[model samples]
Target chain A: MTEAVAIENLSVTFTGGSKPVRAVDGVSLSLGQGEVLALLGESGSGKSVTLRSLLRLHPPKRSRMTGSIRVAGRDVLELSPGELADFRGGVVSMIFQEPMLALDPVYTVGAQITEAIRRHEKISAADARKRALALFERVRIPSPDRRLDAYPHEMSGGMRQRAMIALALACRPSVLLADEPTTALDATVQIQILLLLRELQRELGLSIIFVTHDIGVAVEIADRIAVMYAGRVVESGSVRDVIRGPRHPYTRGLLASRVERAQKGDRLETIPGSPPDLTALPPGCAFAPRCSLAAPQCREIVPPLAEVGPAHTAACIRVAETV
Target chain B: MIIGEPAHLPDGPDRGGPAQPLLSVRDLVKHFPVKGKGLFGKGAVVRAVDGVSFDIRKGETLGVVGESGCGKSTTARLLMHLIKADSGEMVFDGEKVGADLDLTAYRRQVQMVFQDSYASLNPRLTIEESIAYGPQVHGVSAAKARAKAHDLLARVGLEPGRFAGRYPHELSGGQRQRINIARALALEPRLVILDEAVSALDKSVEAQVLNLLQDLKDEFGLTYVFISHDLNVVKFIVDRVMVMYLGKVAEIGEGPAVFGAPRHPYTAALLASMPKMDPDARSAEAPLTGDPPNPINPPSGCRFHTRCALAEPVCSVQEPPLAAMEGLQEAACLMALPGSGHSRAPAPVEAAA
Candidate 1:
C-alpha cells in the first residue's frame, strides 16, 4: 500500500523574547491509503499542533516548524504560497472542531461548497452547483436542495458538522485531517458523523488523521492509535492492542480513569496530578511524577519507542518488563 | 441491576428524614422572547424551559441529561433564579419562593459553575479576589473572605499559595474550571448547579474533577443539580437521573433503572445512540431522525412526539403527563402510561422490528 501521508521528525516551536516553547517535539508518523489513524491526547498534548502542521496552518510569524511533511507525494513545506493554497483544499483538506467558525456565516451552504469545487476544478457555476448538491447528498444531508440555501447560523450543530464534512470532501482530497470534528457535537450526532466518516473513507479510499481527547471515539473509528503526551507520541499501536492492553502509564491511566465501565456507585480511578507544562517539562519521562509504577530508571533516561509486539509500541523504559 | 436500592437516593429530604427539600420546582416554565419583532410584536417565545417539575433533596446530586437546546441549562438557571421562570412555583425549604424574594440571601445559598470557565470568571480579578467576591457580598470581613478563598482553592485541588494571585488567562482550562468550582464553594452554598461543568475538559481531567465533585459532595453535604449533554458522564456521577427532550422531562428514575431499562422511546434511542467504550457492545439501531421540533409551537401532544418512533395518533393529540412506573421510574409517554393497551405486553412493542 502506498503511504498516503508521511511526517518525519516534525517539530513546532513558538519563539518569543527569551525561551522558546517546544509545542511539538521531534515526531514521525505515517498513514496508508484508506487508513484511519487517531491521535489521542489531552489538552496541551500537542495533537492539535501536529495536525495543524500538516497543511502549514500554524501561525508562521511566531511558530517555527522543522522536518518533512509529505502528503500525496508532495513535500508540504516545500510548496510556495500559491502552491500551498492550491495544495491545501485540493490534496489535503481539514475539518475543524467548531464548524460554525470554519464555515462562512454570510455565504449560503451551496455557495461555500461551490466555491470549494470551483477553486480546485475549472468547472462552470451550473456544474459546481450540481457537484455541491451531490456532495451534500453523499454526506446524507436531509433535503439537500433546501439545505444548500441555508446559512451556517441557520443550521443545527449536527447539520453544520455535516456541511463542514461536505466542504472538506468537496474537492475529493486524498487526506482529511479532522481536529476533534465531533467534540462539540452531541453523542448521537457524534456517532452519526463518525459512521459517515468511516463510510466515506471506505468509499473514497481517503486517508484520515483524526485528533481527539476521547478514547471511546478513537476505539470506534481508528485502525491505529497514537497516544500523545506533552509533545511526543507516548504509545502507538493497532486500536485493538492499544485499547485492550495499553503499556504506557499515561495510556493505562487514561483507560483506567474513563467513566465508561463503572457502575453507579463505583469510584472512578483518577490519575493524580496534571499534564506537564510544555515550557518546563520534567527530566526523562514527562509522566514519571504521576506514574504509580515508575522505577528509578524512568527518572534518569528518556525511553525510546520500543516495540512490544507486532505493530504495537510504547515509549516507556519498563515496556519490556511491565507486560 | 439492583432493584429497590435506597442507596441510589442521595441524602435528601425525601429520603425519610424530617428535613424539607432544599429546592422544589413545580411546573417550571421559562420562555425567552424570540429575537425578531413583528405585528404581533411579542414575537415567538423560545420555550427554553417548558413545564418541568422536579425536586433536589438536600445534599444529593440530581443529574439532568439532554442534548443542546433541550432546556437542561435553562432549568439550572431557573433553579438558581438567575433567570426568572414564566410560570412555576419554586419552594425552598418549605417556603414558597417568589420573584420578589430577597435575591441577595438566596444568592449566598445557591452557586453556579458554568460550562465556559473563562467566560464565567472575571479576567481582571485574581483567583483569590474572584472567590472572595461572593463572601464579601454576603457581608463577610475582607480578612475572613480571603481566608475562605484560600480554603476553597485547596478544597477544589488548587494550591492557594501558588494560584491565588494568578489571572484567568494564566491558568489552563482545567485549572480555570477548578477556580470556578472554588468560587462556587466560596460562600459555602447549599445547592450547586454544575452546568456542563466538565464537558469542555479532556477525559482524564474530567475524571479527576468528577472524583473531586464526589468527594466535595460527601464532605460538605452539598446538594447538586448536575446538568450535562453527556449521558455516560451522568450515569457515572448521578444518583437519580432525569432525561429531558424539548424542555420536558421524558424519563425520570434511579440511575440504574433509567440507564439499564429505559421506558420512553426517546430515552431508548438516546441510550442506543451513545457509543459504548467497549468495542464489542456496539448497537445496530439507526440514529434518531430529524432535529428536535421548534419549541415556540412545540408538538401538540408529547413534546417528543414529532421525533418519537413509537408515537401514535394519541401522542399527537393528548399530552402525556409524567407518571410513575413499576419502581422508582417515571416516564411521560403514552406508550408507558398505564391502561394505554401498549403497556399490557411490554415485550411486544419493544421486541417488534
Candidate 2:
C-alpha cells in the first residue's frame, strides 16, 4: 500500500519566558492508504498538537516546528500560501471533537456542505448542492432531502456528527484526520459513528488518523496503535500484538487500570504517579517516575524505540529482560 | 385524618410488614420552562425529571444510569431538595419532605457530591473551610466543625496537614474530588448522592475515587445513590441498578442479575453499546440503531421504542408498567413480563471454577 501520510523526526517547541518547552518531542510515523492509525494518549499528551502540526495549523510565530510532513506526495510544510490553501481540503481534511462548534450555526447544513465542496472543486452551485445531498445520504443521514434544509442546532448530536463527516468527505480527500471524533457522543452514538467511519474508509479507500483518549475506541477501530506519552510515541505496533501483550509499562498500566478487566472482587491497579508536566520534564525517560519496571538506568538515560517483535517496537529499558 | 399508631416502619426484610419505606418518592416531577416562545406562543418545559418514583432502603446503594438528557442529574437534584420539585411526594426516613421541612436537619443527613469538581468547590475557601461549611451550618461549633473536617479529610485519604489549608484551585482534579467527598461526609449523612461524580476523571483517578467510596460506605454504614452515565462504573460501585431512559426507570434489579441477564431491550442495548475493555469479551449483539427519541415529545407509549431492538406493536400502543419477576428483578417492558411471548428464561448461574 502507498503511504498516504508520513512524518519524519517531527518536533514542535514553544518558547515561554526563558525556557523552551518541547510540546511534541522528536517523533516519526506513517499511515498507509485505507489504513486507520490510532494516536492514543491522555489530555496533554501532545496528540492534538502533533495532528495540528501535520496540517500546518499551529500558530507559526509562537510555535516552531521542525519536521518533514508529506501528505499525498505534497510536502505540507514547504507549500506556499496559495498552494497550502488549495491543497488543504483538496488532499486532506480534518474533523474536530465538537461538530457543533466546527459547523456554522447561521447557515443551513446543505449550504455549508455545498460551500466546502465548491472550495476544492470547480462546480456549479446546483451541482454542489446535489453532491452535498448525496454525501449526506452516504453518511447515513435519514431523509437527506429534509435534513439539508435544517441548521446545525436543529439536528441531534449524532446527526450533527454525521453531517460533519459528510462535510469532511465532500472533496473525497485521501487522508482524513479525526481528533477525538467520538468523545462528545453517547456510547450508542459513538458506535454508530465508528461503524460509519469504517464503512466510509472501505468505500472511499481513505487513510484515517483517529485520535482518542479512550483505549476501547482505539481497539475497536485502529489497525495499528501508537501510544503517546510526554509528547513522544512510547509504543507502536499492530493493534492485536500491542493490546494482547503490551511491551511498554505505561501501556500495561493503562490496560490494568480499567474497571472492567479487574477480577470481580479485586481492586483496580492504578499507575503510581501522575503524568509528567511538559514544562519541566525529568532528565531521562519521562514515564520513569510512574513506571513499575523502572531501574536506576531508566532515570539516567532515555530509551529509544527498540524492536520487540515483528513490526512492533517499544521504548523501554526492560522490554527484552522482562517477560 | 386519623394519625397512624406508629409512623415508623418495620426495619426487617419481610414480604409485607409496613407501608412506609426508608425513603419514598411518588410522582416526582421537575420542569424547567424554556425562555423563548416558538410558533405556539408559549414557553415549553424541558421536562427534566418527569414523574420519577423509587424507594431507597436504609443502607443500600441505588445506582441510577442513563444518557445525557435522561434526567439522572435532575433526579439527584430533586432528592437533595437543591431545587423544588414541581409536584411530588418526598418522604425521608419515614417523614414527609416539604418547604417547611427543617432544611438544616435534612441537609445534615442528606448530602450530595456534584460532578464538576472545579465548579462545586469555592476557590477562595480552603479545604477545611469547605468541608466545615456543612457541619457549621447544622449547629456544630466552629472548633468542632474544624475537628470534624480534619477527620473527614483523613478518611478520604488526604493528609490533613498537607491538604487542609490548600484552596480548591491549588489542588489537582483528583484531590479536589477527594475534598468534595470529604465535604459530603462532614455531616455524617446517612445517604450520599454522587451525581456523575467520577465521570470527568481519568480512569486511574476514577478507580481510586470509586474504591474510596466503597471503603467509606463500609466504614460509615452509608447508603449511596450513585448516578452515572458509564454502566461499567455503576456496575462496579452499586449493589442494585436502576436503568433510566428519558424520564422513567427502564429496569431495576441486583447488579449482577441485571448486568448478566438484562430483560429490557433498552437495558440490553445499553450493555451492548458499552465499549468492552477486554477485547476477548466483545459481545455479538447487534448495534443499537437510530437516535434516542426527543424527550420533549417522546414516543407515546415507550420512550425507548424508537431505538429498542425488540420493540413490538404493544410497545408503541401502551406504556408498560414496572412489573416484578421471580426473585429480586423488575423491568418495565412487555417482553420481560412472564406471560409475554418474549419472556427470557431464568439465567443459569456460573459455578466457581
Candidate 3:
C-alpha cells in the first residue's frame, strides 16, 4: 500500500520572538491511503504547526522550516508557487476550528464552494453550482438549496461546519487535513461531523490528518494516534495499544488524568509541573520533571523513539521490551 | 416586610430534607433585546433563560450542561442576581426573594465563581486582598478578613507566604482558579455557582482543579450549581445532571442515570456522542445532527424538535412536560411522556444513516 503522506524529521522554528522558539522539534510521521492519523496535543504542543506545514501555511520570512514533507507522491517543500497553489485545494484540503473565520463572510456559501471548484478545475459556473449541491448532499447538509444561499453568520455553528466541510470536499482532494474541525461544535453536532468524516474517508479513500487537544476525540476518529508533547511526538502507536497501554510517561499521565478513568470521590493522578517553554527547553527530556518514573539518565540524555511493541514507538527510557 | 409576620427567619438546617431544597427556582425567564434591528421596526428577543426551573438540594452539585447560547450561563447569572429575571420566583431557605428581601444577606449566602479568572479578579489586587475583599465588604473586620484569606489560601494549596502577595496575572491558570474557589468560600456561601470554572485549563490541570473542588465541597459542605459544556467533567464532579438544549431542560437525573440510560432523545444523543477515550468503545453511529434552532425564534412545542431524531408530529405541535422516569429523574420529551402518544413509535433512525 502506498503511503499517502510522509513527514521526515520535520522541524519548525519562529524567529520573531526575542529568543527563537523551537515550536516543533524533529518529528516524523506517515499515513497510508484511507488511514486517519490524529496528532494529539494540548495548547503550544505544535500539533497545529505540524499540520499547517503540510500545505506550507506558515509565514516564510519570520519562521524557518527544515526536513521534508511529501504528500501524494509530491515533495511539498519543493513546490513552485503555481504548483503549490494547485496542490493546496486540489490535492489536499483543510477544515478549521472556526468555520466563521475560514468562510468568506461577504459571499454566499454557494458562491464560495463554486469559486473553489472553478479555481482548480475548468468548469462553467452552472456546473460548479451543481457540483456544490452534490457536495453539500454528500456531507448530509439538510435543505442543501437554501443553505447554499445562507451566509456564514446566518447558519448555526454545526451548519457552518458542514458547509466548511462541503467547501473542502469541492475539489475532491486525496488527503483531508482537519484542524480541530469539531472543537467549536456541541457534542451532538460534533459526533455528527466526526461520523460524517469517517464515512466520507471510507467512501472516498482519503487519508486524513486530524489535530486536536482531546485524547477522547482522537480515540474516536484516528486509526493511529501520535501523542505530541512540547514539540515532539512522544508516542506513536495503534489506538488500542496507545489507549490500553501507553508506554510514554506523558501519554500515561494524560490517560490517568482523564476524568472518565477516575471513579467518584477518587483524586485524579496528575503529572506535576507545567509544559516546558519552547524558547528554552530542558537539556534532556522536556517531560522528565513531570514523569513519575524518570531516571537520572533521563535528565542527561534525550531518549530516542524506541519501539516498545509491534507497530508501537515511545520516546521514553523506561520501556524495556522491543518488538 | 409582610407586616404580620416576622422580618427574619432562622436559617434552615444545612443538609437535605424532604420538605424543601436549599435553592428553588420556578419559572425563571430572562430576555435580552437584540440591538439595532429593533430601531427600524420590532426588536428581536433573545430568549436566554426561557421558563427554566430546577432545585439545588443541600450538599449536592447540580450540573447544567449545554452548548453555546443554551442559557446555562444565563441561569447562573440569574441565580447570582447579577442580572434580574423578567419573571420568576427564587425561594432560598423558605424565603422568597423580592424587593423587600435582604439582597446583601442573600448574596452572602450564594456566591459565584466565573470561568475567566483573568476578567473576574481585579488586576491590581493581590491574591489575599481579592479573597478578603468579599468578607470586608460584608462587615468583617479587616484583620479578621485577612486572617481568613490566609487560611483559605493555605486550604486551596497555594502557599500564602508566596502567593498571597502576588497579583492575579502572576499566577498560572490552575493557581488562579484555586484562588477563585477560595474567594467564593471566604463568603461562607452555602451555594456556589461555578460557571465553566475549569473549562479553560488543560486536561491534567482540569483534573487537579476538579479534585480540589470535590475536597472543598466536602470541607465547606457547599451546594454547587456547576454549569459546564464538558459533559465528562460534569459527570466526574456533579451529583445530579441537568441537560439543557435551546434554553430549556431536556433531562434532569442523577449523574449515572443521565449518562447511562438517558430518557430524552437529546440527552441520549449527547451521551452517545461523547467521544470515549477507549478505542474499543467507538460509537456505532452519530445519534443526531444539526445545530440547535435559533433561540430568538425557537421552534414551537419542543425547542429540540428541529434537530431531534425521535421527533414526532406531536413534538412539533404539543410540548412535553417534565415527566417522571424510572428513577428520581425527569425528561421533557414526547417519547418519554406516557400520554404523548408517540411513546409507542418504532425505533428512531440514526441521523448519520
Candidate 4:
C-alpha cells in the first residue's frame, strides 16, 4: 500500500514556555492512501501538536521541530513559502475543533471557500463559487445557497462545523486533519458529523488523521487507532484489534474505564494517576506513574514500539511477556 | 403532582399519608427576552425552559440528558434558585420552597457544581478558604468551618495538609474538580446539582471522579441532579434518566427503561445517536437531521418535530403532554398514547385491553 503521509522521529519542542516543553517526543506515524487513522489522547497528549505539525502550523521562532515529514511525495519541512501555501490546501487541509475560532469572522463562509479553491487552482471566480456551493451541499449544510452567504456567527455550532468541513475540502486535498472536530457538538449532531466525515473520507478516497479524546468517536471512524500518552504513541493497531485487545496498560485502562463497558451501578475501573507534565517529564516512560503494571524497568528506561502481533505494536516491556 | 417511582422507589413506605418526594417541581418556566434587531421592533423571548416538571425522589440521582439549548442546564439553575424562574412552583421535602421553606435556609441544603472548575473556584482564595466560605456565610464559626473543610477535603481524597494551602491555579483539572466537590459538600447539602461536572475531565480521570462521587453519595446519603450530554455516563450513573429536547421533557423513567426501551420518538432517536462501543456496530445513518430549531421561536406544537424522524402532521398541530405510558416509563409522544391521534398508535380498545 502506498504511504500517503509519513513522519520519522518527529519531536516538537515549544521553547517559549518557562521550560522548553517537549510536546511531541520521538513519534513516528504513517498513513495509507484512502485510510483513516485516529490519534486518541487527552489534553497535553501532543495529538493536536502532531496534527498541526503536518501543516507546519506552529510558530517557528517559538517552537523547534526536529523531524522529517513527507506528504504526497513532498518533504513538508523543505517546502518553500509559495509551495507551502499551495500544499496546505491543495495537498493537505485541516478542520479544527471550534469552527467559530478557526474560521475568519469578517468574511462570508462562501467567500472563504471560494478563495481557497481559486488559490489552489487557476479557476475563475464564478467556477470557484459554484464549487464552493457544491462542497456545502456535499457536507449536507441545509439551504446551502442561503447558508453560503451567511457569516461564521450566523450559523449554529453544528452548522459552523459543516461549513468548516466544506472549507477544508474546498481544494480536494488528499489528506484531511481533523482535531476534535465533533467534540463541541451535541451527541445527535456529533454522530451526524462523524458519519458525514466517514462518508466523505470514503467518497473522496481521502487519507484522514482524526485526533480526538473520545474513544467511542475513534472507534466509530478510524480504520486504525493510535493511542497517545504524553506525546508518545503507546499502542497502535487495526481498530478492531486495538479496541478488543489492547496490550499497553494505559490502553487497557482507558478501554476498561469507559461507561459503555460497565453495567449500571458498577464502579468504573480507573487509572490511578494523571498524565505527566511535558516540561518535566519523568526519566523513563511518561505513563509509568499512571500505569498499573509499571515496574522498576518501566521507570528506568523509555519503552520503544515493539511488535506484539501482526501490524500491531505496544510501547511497554511488561506487555512483551503477556503477548 | 408528584410522579412516583413505583418500582425503584425508596424502601419503607410512609406510615402516615402518601410519601412525599424529596423535591417536586411543577410547570417550571424561564424565558429570556432577546432585544429586537431594530430598536423600535418588538422583542422576542428565548424559550429556555418551558413548562418542565419532574420529581426527585429521596436518595436518588436523577440524570438530565440533552443537546445544547435543550434547557437541561437552565432547569438545573432554576432548581438551585440561582436564577429565579419566570413562573413555577418548587416543593422541597413536602414544604413549598418559597412559601414554607425560607430561601436562605433552602440555599444551605442545595448546592451546585458547574462545569468550569477553575472559574467556579476563587483564584485568590486557598482551597480550605473556598470550601469554608460557604459554612462561614451560613453562621458556622471560622474555626469550626476550617475544621470541617479539612474533613471534607480528606473525604474528597485530597489530603488537607497538602492541598488546603493551594489555590485553584495550583491544581490540575481533576484535582480542582475534587476540590469543587469537597466545597459543594461543605454545606452538607441534601441535594447537589452537577451541571456537566465531569464533562471536562479526561476519560480516565472522569472514571476516578465518578467512583469518588458514588462513594461520597453513599457516605453522605446525598441526592444528586446529574446533568450531562454524555449518554453513556448518564446511563451508568443515574438511577433515573430524563431526556429533554427543545425545552421539553421527551422521556423520563427508570434509567434502564429509558435507555433500553424508549417510548418517545425523540428519546429513541437520542439513544440511537449514542456512539456504540463495538466498532463493528457503527450507526449507518444519523438518527436525526438538522440542528434543533431556534429556541427563540421553537417549532409549533412539538418543538422536536423539525428534527424528529417519526414526526407526523399531528405533531405539528398539537403538543403531547408528559404522561405515563402503558409500560413503566412516561413519554411526551403522540404515539405513546393510544388515543393521541397518531397513525401508528395502538387502538384505544387494544390499549385498554
User: Which candidate comes out best when scored by lDDT?
Assistant: 4
Give the alpha carbon lDDT tens digit for every residue of B1-353 in model 1: 12222211232333335467788889998988877664235678888888898888777789999877789988988888888788989877765775534566566668899999899999999999999987676667788889888988998889899999999999988899999998888767778999999998878789889988988988877888889888888888988899998899999988889988998888888887777676666444446865566667777987887777776777777888887778789998877665554443244333222
DockQ of each: 0.58, 0.44, 0.61, 0.82
lDDT (CA) for every model shown?
0.85, 0.82, 0.87, 0.90
Model 2 residue runs over 4 Å out of place are A16-20, B1-22, B39-43, B99-101, B277-286, B338-353
Per residue, candidate 3 scores C-alpha lDDT tens digits across A225-319 of 99999899999999999989888888888888988877767799887876777877888888988887888999988888988889999998887
Interface RMSD for model 2 amounts to 2.4
Clashes of 2: 0
RMSD of each: 5.7, 5.3, 5.0, 4.3
Please provide, for model 3 over B127-243, each residue's C-alpha lDDT reduced to its tens digit, 9 standing for 90 to 100: 999999988876677888899999999999988999999999988788899999999988788899999999888787888888888888889778899998888889888899998
Q: Which run of 10 residues does model 4 chain A get worst, by summed lDDT?
A: A314-323
- Model 4 vs. true fold: TM: 0.96
Q: Which residue pairs in model 4 clash with each other?
A: none
Query: Candidate 1: where is the Cα deviation over 4 Å?
Result: A16-18, B1-19, B37-42, B99-101, B281-285, B341-353
lDDT of 4 by residue, B1-353 (tens): 12221211232322122467778999999998888673324677889999999999888999999889999999999999999999989988877898887787677778999999999999999999999998787767788889999999999999999999999998899999999999998877888999999999999999999999999999988889999999889999999989988888989999988888998888888888888878899889999887777788888887777877788899998888887865568998888767779897767866452
Give the CAPRI class of candidate 1: medium
Error of 2 at B150 (Å): 3.1
lDDT of 2 at A246: 92
lDDT by residue (tens digit), candidate 2, B1-353: 11221111222232232454556788999888766675334776677777887888767788999777888888999899899889999877766776434665566678899889989998889999999987666666788889888988898988999988999998778889999999888877778999989988866577788778888988987889999878877887787898888888888888898999987888888888887655556434437876776666667787787877677776787777787776587888876554443434233243311
How well does each candidate superpose onto the true structure, as a TM-score? 0.93, 0.92, 0.92, 0.96
Question: Clashing residue pairs, candidate 1?
Answer: none
